[model samples]
Target: MKRKHQILTIPNLMSLFRLCLIPLIVWLYHKKEMYGLAAFTLVVSGITDVADGIVARRFNMVSNFGKAFDPVADKLTQFAMLVCLAVRFHWILVPMCLILVKEILTGILKMAVIRKTGIVEGADWHGKVTTVLLYITIFLHLAWYEIPDVWSIALTALCTAMMLISFILYGIRNLKLLKNRKY
Candidate 1:
């Protein structure tokens, strides 16, 4: 099973576009005070995220680079949104920090696993659900300026809890993989 490293594939291009949207979204949300455009950018990024995966699997255009690049783009976009929102909603910082920590630890574990076993443990159902919840939470914050402060805080806390659960599950899976490795 020779994995390709092609860079010109459709999915890779879509992932790159999603990465490009991060800065634009930040500028719109923070500098220009264009919440509508910012929210739209996020929606587009999310659409592309799903589209890339479908195209990759449907067209058999999956590559090692795509496998890695797609998730990096997704995380960066999510982190950018969190940072932008945290400027206004301080509670967002909690989930932002948790996500940062989770990404750092899981990223290291993932690389170690790939080096040892040549297997990339992609996003599980829990991780995907966490991502969806994060997106929904962000959208609620962005789209509804009238949302009560308490509600926003509660949603952010819920997102944080789900993220923590995802982090724990990934950690357990990685530890199991490490334990099974033959020294």
Candidate 2:
């Protein structure tokens, strides 16, 4: 059975499209004063994120490229959103930096593991939960203008804590894999 490694699969396409939306989202948020439209675009990007995963799994269109590209798109979008919001809410930089460091470390670990074991680890529950919480937090900041500043700060801090926990969990899991290596 030949596996499709093509870059133009449905899921890959959707992921690419999601990447494309980031600049538009940023522009809408910053230049156009279109918070509502920017938020809608973000929601659409999230939908595409979920849809791509489901379509890839259901249709057996998963590839190594998809495995890699999907998360890149996700992280890029999340980072962009946080940065954009940080312009308004400076405290958001805390979580933004945390998540960015976590991603960089995890990405390095993933590359090492794949080089040694050829295993590409998928998203764990903790990571998924963190991502969802991040999206919700961003959405709230974008849409709920009535939310108090204190509440927004609290939410971002909570998300940052979760992001740290997820990073630690992933580190533990990957470290164990490395320890078990038969070298």
Candidate 3:
């Protein structure tokens, strides 16, 4: 009955629920042209994500499944939004590309490192902040229903910078971990 094995519990099911909403959000955005509804869906999904994590921690429900599924759900939600926005705006493709590349590379690197070293990667504070900023930036775009003006650009730039910083921090942390290992 170790904690890591409870990956298929209720909280994880809730996390899966959030992942299931991505298609509905995208459908609202593209077919119905309901940006407001899409934003609302995003907000709901985000809240559920936070709730699932909190529930898992508070109730001692941490499981390997939760760890894996949480990030996968998060990536799916964000990537779904990115694809929808990029298709609609076309101008955001560059930044979206950068973000996706960073995420994918980081994921691959994490897996390889974990396999070699037996250390699981957890989301650090900076990574969490970057995720929050990304959600905010996309939410604002949905709110505005157009290319954001100067303020949004500034905020997006700030968020992107934070994302990069978090990326560097994760890399450094892993390097230190490797140095300390007996391998």
Can you tell me which runs of candidate 2 are displaced by over 4 Å?
none
lDDT of 2 by residue, 1-183 (tens): 334566779999999999999999999989997888999999999999999989989998888778889989989999999999998899999999988899999999888887888776778899899989999999888888567999998999889989999999999888877778632
TM-score of each: 0.94, 0.94, 0.89
Most accurate candidate by lDDT: 2
TM-score between model 2 and native: 0.94
Error of 3 at 44 (Å): 0.6
lDDT of each: 0.88, 0.89, 0.80
lDDT of 1: 0.88
Ten contiguous residues with the weakest lDDT in model 2:
1-10
- Listed per candidate, the RMSD to the true structure in angstroms reads 2.0, 1.9, 2.1
lDDT of 2 at 85: 90
Question: What is candidate 3's local distance difference test score?
Answer: 0.80
Better-scoring candidate (lDDT), 2 or 3: 2
Q: What is the Cα-based lDDT of residue 139 in candidate 2?
A: 88
1 or 3, greater by TM-score? 1
